[model samples]
Target: MRIVQEFTKGFWKELPPFKLVLGLCPTLGVTTTCYAGIGMGLATTFVLVCSNILVSSLRSVIPSKVRIAAYVVIIASFVVMVEMATQAWVFPLYKGLGVFIP
Candidate 1:
């Protein structure tokens, strides 16, 4: 079905940090070990999904003039929150990611 195709597309067709060619630098930079790689991948996925949901929900309410800035703010907030949570709960990963996040 079309829905399933759209959902599964990322697994291979548009696989992130590879075929898509977006944010590949961080993917390679932070992934020194398998555990670190998985942690970074999940964090990236979470931030993207959260930002998408927030932007889509606010699309109607936001003015076109500042839409880009608004999305940046939303994405930045999510990233910061994730970073703090990782720092507090998963100090090892926080350390592993090192300067890559900033």
Candidate 2:
């Protein structure tokens, strides 16, 4: 089925550091240690899911001409919140990621 193919493809066909090939900069930069990598990954996943939901919910209302800007604003807001949370609770991670999160 199409759903199975979609799930399986992520393992090899479209997996990062291989076929997918996008966003390599961040992956390489933050993956110096397992803890740093996992921390950054979870934070990123949270922001991505939140931003996706916000974007989808507002898709109908956002103007076509400024959709890109609107999406950026939505994602940026979540990023700021995540950065603040990390700084407050996980100072080491926030410091490790440094300029990457900003």
Candidate 3:
């Protein structure tokens, strides 16, 4: 129950893009099509998850001064890999999402 509650909390309370408006540009742009919206949301979620795991693992190694740069590099690399993979294998989805790939 607690686990479900914790997960459910995000449904209305802690939506990263909607509540905080963190990724409004992509949210707004991608939402024009339902497929694009889902694609963008999943992509963002993947990046967030990967970055969170990397940062948590490297928290001790990353200095407070340079953590931001390290995080950006990690996130950018994941985004590039996702973009390339999608372009190569899911060409139709990639074409549909064109400029928004990255």
Candidate 4:
């Protein structure tokens, strides 16, 4: 089905970071620890998904000139929230990660 194809295409063909190699530094560095790698990957995925949704919703309203700034602000806010949540609830993992996070 076309719908299934649309969804499945991303799995092997259009991965934002893996396929495009967009965030190689974090990908390579975080992957040393399996837990840390998974956590960071999920965090990146969350930010990407949230930013996509927000930008899609505001696409018509936002001026093209400032879209990059808008997207950065949205992504940064989510990252901060994630960082705080990790520090508060998973202090051990947070400590293990060290400066990679903050």
Candidate 5:
């Protein structure tokens, strides 16, 4: 029963970009136009997936006290990657996304 409850909690109770409403500020800021929205969504998705994989893989090694700091560092690195990629390949998007990229 505990295992089932945990599974349901994680899988059903915590849907993203909707129920959880993570990064709401950036979502509102960058989605002014369709093209900007698409670009921001793609970048955000890439960062999220990559960051999750990396963080899960490192969870065992990361100390409990600094777990959040570690996760932030990992995610920030991916954010920087997205920023550089956009600046190099799509300067317009880099400009359009603006402060929301950070």
Candidate 6:
């Protein structure tokens, strides 16, 4: 019952982090310019959606004891990919982001 409840809760509830002040960087640095905000939002959305898909698909394969570590690694890899891509092509946004990407 609890497992079913947990699985169904996401359909109705928002992610916990969004309700928190976890995106101080985007709210501050990226807000300076519309383009910067768009770039940051796109990068964040891509990483988040991709990572969620990957993690949900691999949840059964990942070990219970180290699932959090596995998730972090997965998210980190996506973040690195986004960062590298941003730096390579969107140099302006990359420079604007500064310390926020990592």
Per-candidate TM equals 0.78, 0.77, 0.71, 0.70, 0.75, 0.75
Backbone clash count, each prediction separately: 0, 0, 0, 0, 0, 0
Candidate 1 regions with alpha-carbon error over 4 angstroms? 1-19
Cα lDDT, model 1, residue 94: 93
Residue-level lDDT tens digits of model 6 in 1-102? 998888667644566765455554564566678888888888888988999999999999999999999999999999999999999999998998878788
- Alpha carbon lDDT of residue 27, candidate 6? 48
Query: In model 5, which runs have C-alpha deviations exceeding 4 angstroms?
Result: 1-18, 22-24
Question: What residue pairs are clashing in model 1?
Answer: none
Better of 2 and 5 by TM-score: 2
Candidate 4 backbone collisions, by pair: none
Q: Residue 51 CA error for candidate 1 (Å)?
A: 0.4
The digit string of per-residue lDDT tens for model 3 on 3-81 reads 8998889776787666566555766676767877787788778888987998899999999999899988998998898
lDDT of 1 by residue, 1-102 (tens): 998898789666776556556566677877789988998899899999999999999999999999999999999999999899999999999999988766
Q: What local distance difference test score does each model get?
A: 0.88, 0.87, 0.80, 0.78, 0.89, 0.85
> lDDT tens string, model 2, 43-96?
888888999999999999999999999999999999999999999999998998
Worst 10 residues of 5 by lDDT: 17-26
User: What range of 10 consecutive residues in model 1 has the weakest lDDT sum?
Assistant: 16-25
The CA-based lDDT of model 1 is what?
0.88
TM-score of 5: 0.75
Ranked by TM-score, top first = 1, 2, 5, 6, 3, 4
> Tens digit of lDDT per residue, candidate 5, span 1-102?
999999888877875645646565566677889999899889988999999999999999999999999999999999999999999999999999988886
Per-model root-mean-square deviation over C-alphas: 7.6, 6.7, 8.1, 7.8, 5.8, 7.1
Best candidate, lDDT: 5
Name the weakest run of 10 consecutive residues (lDDT summed) in model 2. 19-28
In model 1, the Cα lDDT at residue 33 comes to 98
Better of 1 and 6 by TM-score: 1
Candidate 2 residues lying further than 4 Å off, grouped into runs, are 1-19
